[model samples]
Target: MNVLKCFNKGQPLPLRIKAADALRYLCSYDPVSQDIRTKITVIMAELLVLSNDNEFDLINEIMDDFVLKYAKELEPFALQLAKNLNIQFLRIAEELMNFSTTQNNDDKVSKEQLDKEYQASSILTNMNTMIITMTSEKDLTYALLGSVEPSIRFVLENCMANFISELMEILESFNYTMKCIVPEAWSIFDLVCESFDNFGFDYVLDYLQYFESIITYSFLEDGNKAGSNNDINAGQKTEEQKTSIKNEESKIISLVVKLLNEDNGENFADEDLVLFLFKLISLLVLKLGCVNF
Candidate 1:
């Protein structure tokens, strides 16, 4: 309990960080009771809210260790951690946007400006690390996904195109089984489709590539396994799962139709992208059944 007091607002950052490190070590090595570990986890989550940008990396290390060692204990705090993370992402997005405007106006970039850019980028890197770490745990995956959905939408809507790949990478981190089990899995795709107008054709194509991979893995591979197996109902999906996947497929097709109808193909005038779209449609038809749009 004394160690937890070091995280008081009056405490220095280094001291707080040291206290966090010490607690992490004790949680991992000491024969602590479940209640003590749960208390420590709650304290650590609160510390994240109080942490500044400079301390993100150190705090993330401690949080990651806590997640690894005490995932079940940390499950109750998933939503809290996710909300804190989204706040960080938004703060960094604003910083990156301001830095971009400053860079655009300045003819010669100063060392100070470069350092600011690097610091902003590092904060994002650490946030991504935390996201991947948290989402890898099955119990926390859906809760985190649902909590961070707004952040996902905000990033896509706001002109953060460069960071879209990072979002896609995070989505890709979920395995096939989780996708089938988690009803909120399709929320990301729904948000992407909603934000299509904000993206350029190149980014659209990047998103399409990701969609194709997901469709192939979730539908095609599973279909093949079912086809070869004697017991078709061995791993059958529940009716609710079937409905959820169907809704997802419809959303994807709707997005494709919207893309095709844009400017009567003028927007997709690039032959290569057009071909890729057709190929994706064909894949969908083959694996997921007829593509209406």
Candidate 2:
């Protein structure tokens, strides 16, 4: 209890670190009670929320090892932990953005700035690792997705282009591993479409290609060519699956048409993008037989 109390924001950093070390050591014992493990996980989550860049490495170690090591015992707190991590990620992202702006204004970088950048990078990597690890657990993934949608949108809309691209890659890996599509997944596509102007053509094209791949994976069957599996096998899709595919196809088509209609020859004028969209719409039409368009 005293060690847990030392995680409070009012505690000195060195004292908190030592206390965290002690807590981690104690939690690792074979004789520790399940109740004590749960309490330790709770305290760790709270400490993460209070942690800053100075505590990045320790927090990363706890997240990467300690959290996962006790994941089963701590399953009940998955959503709470995800929310806390998201809050911490937002804080770190803001720091990174500030560092980016600072770097842009200065002709030469300093040691302090480089150190800060490295710390921010480490935090970002740690958060990514934690996210991927959480997603590997079915219950944890469900809990994580419930709270992570806003963070996804924020990263997509506000972060630097490189970070936005990295986020898309992470989401792609998420989709590939999860296999089933969730509503939150579609929000990523929607945000990409809505923010078309902010991202470059290459990024937009990559997203479209990703969307196309998702369509193929979700809607088509093996041995049949893409868009040629009109008479899908009865075993291939459940009623719910069919409904989901139909809705997502409609949504994608609508987004494409809206982009085309609203384009005043400024954005969406890239020949490659236009050609790709044309091909994608054609594929969707072939699969659906008739889209209301």
Candidate 3:
């Protein structure tokens, strides 16, 4: 408790590490009481919210280790921890997964690659560990997929469907398809809505606008990805990849159509939504070549 208090009250890095190490030792070696375990979980969850580099790295290490080894004993407090921290961990993971795409062979490797890549590469590198915890321990089979952000999900629904076709057309010059390990968009849209229930119709409006950014990044006609060493290659498009992408997009379009059909303009009733709506419409016209209605 003293260690935790000192750490939480803003101890120096060494002190914080010392205290955190002590906590780790107690949780692993000593048979801490249930109350202590509960308290520890709450602290760990809170540290994730803190999201400082040191704190997040330490707590992620602790929970990732403890959650699996002591799964049977740790469920109650783990749930509280997961609930309190909620989606933040997943967001970190998604950001990490998406991080790979931001660079390509053509991009000059920076001296600060370690710091720049650490955030995402850490999760991607440790994914096997995370998958084991998620599947065997936490019972969330597709939690990573479930946790992918709305913007990325939008890209997946479009890019992955026409993935091969789109890649052949837009990214054939590119050597890297760093956008792997994605999930279907339709399933995630429901969850996205659930996740942002507090924001109501405005969330939908914002996301539609966010889709425009994806449009700009994805559909370049010159076949030059800003960060990639894309070499020309059309023969790489596999029939199976195309088929899978089509199926995923087909489902996503259902929801898209539903939203389009449902919008009789009242949902944009908020004065604030007009700017977003107009921007989105312009993006659709400029990027997608949609006929202006």
Candidate 3 displacement at residue 38 in angstroms: 2.4
CA deviation > 4 Å runs, candidate 3: 33-36, 52-59, 70-112, 124-130, 134-139, 142-144, 149-293
**TM-score for each of the candidates:** 0.57, 0.55, 0.37
Cα-based lDDT at residue 155, candidate 2: 68
Q: How would you encode candidate 1's per-residue C-alpha lDDT over 148-190 as one tens digit per residue?
A: 6666676766767766766665555543324432335556566
TM-score of candidate 1 to 2 decimals = 0.57
Position 285, candidate 3: lDDT? 64
- Writing each residue's lDDT as its tens digit, candidate 2 over 173-272 gives 5555455455566667667656555654657654655566556545544432233322222235566856665676566677667766877876665777
Clash totals, every prediction: 0, 0, 4
- The segments of candidate 1 whose C-alpha lies over 4 angstroms from its true place after superposition are 1-9, 18-39, 52-56, 102-140, 174-177, 181-187, 190-213, 216-293
lDDT of each: 0.60, 0.59, 0.42
Model 2, residue 157: C-alpha shift (Å): 1.5
Worst 10-residue lDDT window, candidate 1: 224-233
Whose lDDT is higher: candidate 1's or candidate 3's?
A: 1
